[model samples]
Target: MSDERSYPTGIGTSTTDRIQLLGLDLADEVLGKVSFGELAYWLATKRRPTPGQLRVFEAALVSLADHGYTPTAIAARMTYYSAPESIQGAIASGLLGGGSRFLGVTEDTGQFLAASIAALGDTSGYSEDDWDAVARDVLEKAKSEGRKVPGLGHPVHKQGDPRTPVMFQIAREAEVFGPHLSLFEAIGRVHPEVLGRTLPLNGAGVAGASLADAGLPLGLLRGFALLARTAGLIGHLAEEQQHPVGPAIYAEVDRNATYVPPAP
Candidate 1:
């Protein structure tokens, strides 16, 4: 038996005199040449995206980057107030809040749309009406199961999500609008009939669909969301350092808290 092992990775490697990322010089070739968005997609897919794909991917990143005073931001700010020394902790605290209700919708909606589309074996011939029919079936099945259709409603944007159409426009212009997006848009159109009321296809959900169409992996959908949110949380922390609202938020909640007796 030989006591030798080899580990191979195409991502990054360090040598005595240089560092290489994706088999390119980190300092000379990749430093100022590649945009962060492009770099992210390349890293994820191990292939550089075309200009159109880059636009859609970056658009998704921007869409999920920030939403004012969301629970994730509040958690980060609150944690910062308590432990100013640990910015990492504050950022992690915010990211920890990404679940089914908050920032997890991107993954939920993507997975839902992807799975639904996968069930239809040959969608190469699917038409607009066919897509709508598929969307109706998906919505009906979800409703029958008593499950809220992900990406179909927004708590804040009752009339519509402003980010949804913008993302759609970007994807359409990029020409990367694949079945994931087509099906999602179909759901938006037909959901009112299925659910008895119209709900906007939200921004996060659109981001997911857009990303999926952009050739990213299904399992990494939520990771992309978190990557975008990392930028947002950093912004919140930066604002906290200047204006310091975390303490006020904590005090406001603390002051309003009330206790009641437990029932036997």
Candidate 2:
């Protein structure tokens, strides 16, 4: 019965010499015909992307590829320094930090936007104020309950995330700009009126909106984030080889730590 509990997925399969993905032969049918971004979409969704969807997916992947000196990159570098033999360990450690608002905000924002849209189902005649009110109410309620609204603010780029505008443009060009994107934009506009501050669109917010608009599954957003950053993590690890910054980062953090002496 243990073997009877096998799980099934349409993702991919491998044999001795052949690999297949989404029913297409990997080497013969897919290798040169598709970009990695398009292949990525296929692996996740079991379908090919429209040119527009490919653009947005590519943008999201590139946008999150590497934020210089991010915690994830730092962790990857440090892990590489400590365990030079285990590059995979470094990558894994970096990805492990990507929950909540860290690097996983793209997933959080997508899920949040999906839920918000679902809650406002059948908006046949919702006026601008009505939709805005609904959004503000939702935001306020989440705030009152001390919930972290994913993908709104950023630590740096106070004016706006440079990536956000580009992602929005890509979505617009792709014609995938839908309610989720609108909801995030609306939230941005109504933020000052409702929350007494402006929280402009960040990259994660754009990622969420774009993926949702592009019709990707909400549950897969986190996986997408990890995949996107894996490219960046690989870059960081490679850089750590020639120009090692991991030790310096570690030493700087160590210097900043205020040790509390244990009771004698």
Candidate 3:
């Protein structure tokens, strides 16, 4: 064997004379030419998206960016309050809070939709009624298994999630609407019959379907949500620097705590 080591990556690389990303000149072809949203999709899929795909992808990103003082945002602000000097820590604290109850739903919904679609085998020429039937079966199986449907409801949006329809519209206009989205919409239509009363297809779930339809990898759906939320967290930190509510939040919770003795 020769005394040499090789590292291979399709993402990015740099040397003395040139920097390359996704087989393009990062300085000449990418910078000032590609939007950050487009660049993110290109970097992830190793394939440049069409204008429609980019629109749908970025819409998904924007939908998941922030939702006003969610636990992740609070965690970020509180971490910033506790460690004012470590901005990265504050951002990390926010991202770390993206779990099952929060940002993780993006991936969960995408995976659920994808799995349901895959189970249909040959899905060619599947009509709306066919998709609704598929959606019914999917919900019925999930109900039987006692699994909470990830993107079916929201805490605040009892009437409807405004973002859900907007995402569907964007996907429709972009012409990137695909099976995942079709199935999700079917779920919205037919879920009342399966699970009783209606639940709006929340934004997070719609974002997942939108991302999946945009041809992004199912596994990286949550990562995309986190990428968007990173921007939101930075905004929160900037506000924390200016108006500074982290301490107030901390104080409110701290003052409300009551001590309760454990049984001996």
Candidate 4:
């Protein structure tokens, strides 16, 4: 007699595996039960934050919703104008341009300050003298390296970035202060001297720091920034529909250039 017992080949394999992998069990759990707000609350908190926390989160989102036609917004608008049927494609085009270099300055700012702190060790606490020493050292290094401090200065906002103070205030109210904030404050103190004028925290810097303080991963910051900017991009798309810029404008062509003959 054969020693082996007969077993169906598909029984413990494909058929059973397919049934186990199917998510039909959770079907009823997700059927028209939650509104977007409720869903967002659930996802964010695993429950829900206090009303106050919700308000702060809303404010942050609202405050960052738009900032004119930045490069990303322009790209989005251009894509939308060309391909009106695919809004997602336009938005994706815009998002591709959104990165840490574009909208989140916290990592760079944190790195700069962290380096300064390490260089100045034991002198980076809350003490004014300690802070000043660190700032001076960082500033000198920046000067020598011909690099600007990341969180300071803005091209368009001459006086100061209006968003900076608001974010700092929000962080204070939320009672969440960490190394990012300390670096921001330190940079704020030194920026005036370094730039020969007062430099206010820009939106990117504030958003970066706030997200970092919230214990969010640095990689997610760019997505948040892009999401915030999408509001502005949509608005621009709408405006462009009303009053279009026509075809793309290019720099003047060099009509006098000599043409080379193709190889024989």
For this target, which candidate reaches the highest TM-score against the unseen true structure? Answer: 3
* lDDT by residue for model 4 (1-264), tens: 989997743212234334311222223443465434334433543554454444444455556677776777777777776788888888788778765556655455545545555544443256755566567767777888998887776778867788888877877787665566666677778767765778667767766666555544454555556666677777777776787642342112235456899999
Candidate 2 Cα errors over 4 Å, as ranges: 1-9, 15-17, 123-131, 253-258
Residue-level error in angstroms, candidate 1, position 9:
2.1
Ranking by lDDT: 3, 1, 2, 4
- Candidate 3 stretches with Cα past 4 Å from truth are none
Residue-level lDDT of model 2, residues 1-264, one tens digit each, is: 365676786888999999988888989998888888898887778778889888888888888888888888888889999999999999999999888867688888988888888867776566667767767977898889988678888999888899888887889888987788877877877878777888778997789778888878889988888998999999989889999987887889899999899999
Backbone clashes, each candidate: 0, 0, 0, 0
lDDT (10s digit) by residue, model 1, range 104-152: 9999988988999886887878899999998889989999999887888
TM-score of 4: 0.66
Candidate order (TM-score): 3, 1, 2, 4
Clashing pairs in 2: none
Question: Each model's TM-score, in the order given?
Answer: 0.96, 0.90, 0.97, 0.66
lDDT by residue (tens digit), candidate 3, 1-264: 998999889898999999998889989998899899998998899899999999999888888889999999999999999999999999999999999889998999999999888867877688999999998999999999999888999999988999999999999999998999999999999999999989989999999999999999999999999999999999999999999998888889899999999989
Q: Is candidate 3 or candidate 4 better by TM-score?
A: 3
In model 4, where do residues sit more than 4 Å from their true spots? 1-58, 99-101, 104-107, 110-125, 195-197, 238-264
Which has the better TM-score: candidate 1, or candidate 2?
1
Q: After superposition, how far is residue 143 of candidate 4 from its true place, in Å?
A: 2.5
Worst 10 residues of 4 by lDDT: 18-27
lDDT score at residue 184, model 3, on the 0-100 scale: 95
